[model samples]
Target: MTACGYRVGGQGASLPTEIKVIAVPAFENRTPWMRLEQRLTAAVMQEFIHRSRYRVVGKEQDADAVLRGAVTSATTTPVIFAPETGRASAVQVAVRVSVELRDRRTRATLYANRDFVFREQYEISSDLDSFFEERDPALDRLARDFAASLVSAVLENF
Candidate 1:
């Protein structure tokens, strides 16, 4: 038997059945950060393609299952202060993601988890370039890591 307990179509050879296709919906961002929805959606889609057995589908209607996620919290805190200027030298940013997997046809949840936190530190730049430049990159990376972990957890349980 394969990992997923299915045999190959013709050969009686055991092979894991592919998840094949999934849909990721735009995540709801409760934080003040506006672009998190788009960034997280993209990250989850990429994770499905990269780390999982599933192929990400462009449309929800086309998918066998749907993976939905939300950004429950995104926060940044000054961790280190420069003595000379009393300015923040380093900041720790954390992103919390909640995800659920559901069968598209039955609308039944297969797996669900909440408050998966991913954190990263960023150095304070001397000059302010843009808010997004400072925040979005780290947030995106956190989201991507969270997605990867989530996928692994779900697959392992199966």
Candidate 2:
């Protein structure tokens, strides 16, 4: 005889069940990148809205908890080079971010990650006339990924 059972995959919510609302204000940008904070903030808020049932807000006073994020640093390094021109053809953009989630009433930190780093590679356009800024697209993707990761970390209390 054999016994069979089913199990769930996720660890489930680790924070207090009383926290039903969260405020995600614009993240601070310590780096030189322009408007990077806005991108990160918007992405994180959107992720929370899409994935969780919590009521997300922009003002801390309107929510039970608040999530604060900051872009610590950003740099782009050449990863691939062009054969003929000997110029950089691809770059790896690395960004460091710090985040914290705290209860508004108690001011207790629910989650904190001081130095979370993420990197992505973007190819440079070969045609100079058609060249466009790749940083924006890369940053957008990075922000989305960071948001998903941040939400997961908070939910898992990691």
* Top-lDDT structure, candidate number: 2
As a TM-score, model 2 comes out at 0.86
Task: Flag regions of model 1 displaced more than 4 Å.
Answer: 1-18, 129-133
- Give one digit per residue, the lDDT tens place, for model 1 in 34-112: 8887877887778767765567886789887787878888888999988888888788888888888777777777677
Q: Against the unseen true structure, what C-alpha lDDT does each candidate score?
A: 0.71, 0.84
- Cα lDDT tens digits, model 2, 13-72, are 677788999999999999888998998899889888887778889999999999998899
lDDT of 2: 0.84
- Candidate 1, residue 80: Cα displacement in angstroms equals 1.7
Q: List the residue pairs that clash in candidate 1.
A: none
Ten contiguous residues with the weakest lDDT in model 1: 7-16
Error of 1 at 17 (Å): 3.9
TM-score of each: 0.74, 0.86
